[model samples]
Target: MEQNKTLVTEFVLTGLTDLPGLQVPLFLVFLVIYLTTLVGNLGLIFLIWKDPHLHIPMYLFLGSLAFVDACSSTSVSPKMLMNFLSMNHLISLIECISQFYIFASSANTECFLLMVMAYDRYVAICNPLLYPVVMSNVFCTQLLGVSYIIGFLHPMMHVGLLFKLTFCKSNVIHYFYCEILQLFKISCTDPRVNMLLIFIFSVFIQSFTFMSIILSYSYVFFAILKKKSAKGRSKAFSTCSAHLLSVFLFYGTLFLMYVLPGSGPCENQDKMYSLFYTIIIPLLSLFIHSLRNKEVIGALRRIMKINSS
Candidate 1:
């Protein structure tokens, strides 16, 4: 493989804007998105930390999710925003690789983290008596640790797979960021194996995760109905509604973007879908989690009161 080493000193990113007029508008929109993502995720992290009442397995998971969302959005959005301002959105090869790696890792982490959260909810509602035992701090840490480890590990393989290919052709990527799909057409080497690997993994992992969550929720729903009191069932359902919504939004868009048999996203459409996951979804998670969460609201009020006093 070293014989074909082009040394790959630089890559040119296509970025989100080929149109001059759209640059400022896109920049402003992304700027607002970036700001909101930062504040919302950071606020969740702070609320989780400050509120003693929120010191549960669920909040811990929420805190981890917020952190991941913040990192994930920052990984691509800031660079995207900068692209709008500059004359050329060209990024060096190493920088592009770095961007791809970060984006891939953070995104994969979110998927695994969401799975863990589903399991957490399953244990809570399906077997309340054993929730603490099943989701112990030690087990929770181990699950989260596995998610982070897999994040980088899987992407590292993909990057290595990419490294084997040659790219003497145009370096300009079609997407805003250095996405794996954009690298496919540029590779001088046959990308059959890489493409197959991506497709297979996408199907296996997403299906497994989705089915697991659905089965868990199914059991949870049945269990809730068995509860004699309406109030008890309502509380149980309420506790999981936000998570269900988050799960749906994240997986639905991801499936649309990746799972279907297509050539992948076009330049503009790619940017729009990318925005859904990278910026909007992350910001919405904060709202989704906090909207009906009295614990989070109370904590916010406490912080306000303390600050005011």
Candidate 2:
């Protein structure tokens, strides 16, 4: 164990490229995407905070999701951006572990947050009269608090098991970041425990969250259909659509990346799928929520009009 400790002080990340030509282009592209992600998410958070009309449980959950997306992107993008410009993509052991923890926590938090949002929608649509009482500020705060607590705690288990493993083989990680799966691939120690934990945790988390979302939306759909007024049904559908889109994007990519067992070798495809959720999803979510959301757009316009005056 002592010998293993001295063997790996740092790790080399291959970082999404082997070609010199692709490095600059990838950097420029991701830099733009990263900047957009920051602006969109942070802007949404600010809008939610400043708009009195948005001071509801729904927007509060959206704000939390925005915060998680921004933090998740920050955890990976800056290092990835730097690696694109440098020939040697080296990361210290401590930094690698920290990145994995932050990324995993943010992701786990998002899953829970989305489930909360779906429930919020379910209550609002299916039990409109009781929505105000059930989704009160206290309840929302408790849900957010629980989401964050579970999110951070779940990843710690994986990281704890990971730290015990000794890496005596190669230090070169195949993927861009210090992903738990990729890290497992290079460990000289028995990774069976880590793999089992990942499978168990992933299945538990994904299944619970996914089922909750599905059930919530199912009730929401029936409620909407029961609405006598066409306009009321339309409004309800519009409101639910944004959350549905986000769920589809997040869970769809996640399922493809983690849940589905691969029939054959597809490491590169896995990397791309991971990148989509980690990097691309944050950027996309801002538009998904803001563009279709009448309240957010109205808030933006009001803010813009005030600035013009």
Candidate 3:
């Protein structure tokens, strides 16, 4: 009915925490994380752009990853920070859905990007001879294009499905942002079809990307084991070490959240983990790839020297 539509035009976001005392402190903490995410990810992209030495497939992918991370953080963090200070956590239905779509698309896109990076690493380490020819500029551009396309397309399904359901059961979303599951939970209409479709698509996307990355890494490790020189093996290991760690964190958290059975956490715990991937993961990517990376460090020093002069 028109009454129902008007009744639920706006949804209340539960936000990260409900305690009044925790609000300001959480806001400050997330503010720092948000600011750091912007500075760090943007800084990495800048470093890659400025440093001629990093103009390769690996660095290009890393730069793109940085760009995606900046987008992911921006999509979630500003509103979260604002809600922390304000008593009203009201978000219009359209705004909420749009926010989820942006974040979800970015997330799915990052998964594809990670998969591409795995292939890039495998080519570099497992098939070094063909790496340059195969990962040429055109190919890299296409790979990025495919990743972004799939990422954007996959989430539109859930967004469309969202419009079909009526949310008269409750306008209060139990989690932060307009997560697909939370929206389904509050719908008065039977959400079984929506849930089933979402589950199927989610499984396919996560499994396809995660499995491919795993397979690529497996081959990379196998090839490393065959190296005659210990130094060569060590070098190969070092090359993919940052990437492996990033894959573990990103995929591990996601699997726990969506793929596993009977693994649901309480509302607060869910919020905490959701916060981790949305904001914390971006910051982690910068640290894992750049802060401890010798090449990135060297690149930074060079850029600093140039700027200082």
- The backbone clash count of each candidate, in order, is 2, 0, 0
TM-score list, all predictions:
0.92, 0.96, 0.95
RMSD (Å) of each candidate, 1 decimal = 2.6, 1.7, 1.8
What ranges in model 3 sit over 4 Å off?
Answer: 1-6
Q: Which regions of candidate 2 deviate over 4 angstroms? A: 1-6, 261-264
- Model 1 ranges off by over 4 Å: 1-8, 261-267
Clashing pairs in model 3, backbone N/Cα/C closer than 3 A: none
Candidate of highest lDDT: 2
TM-score quality measure for candidate 3: 0.95
Model 3, 133-210: lDDT tens digits are 999999999999999999999889988988898777689987767777788778888898987887787788889998
Clashing pairs in 2: none
- How much does candidate 1 score in TM-score? 0.92
Q: Worst lDDT window (10 residues) for model 1?
A: 261-270
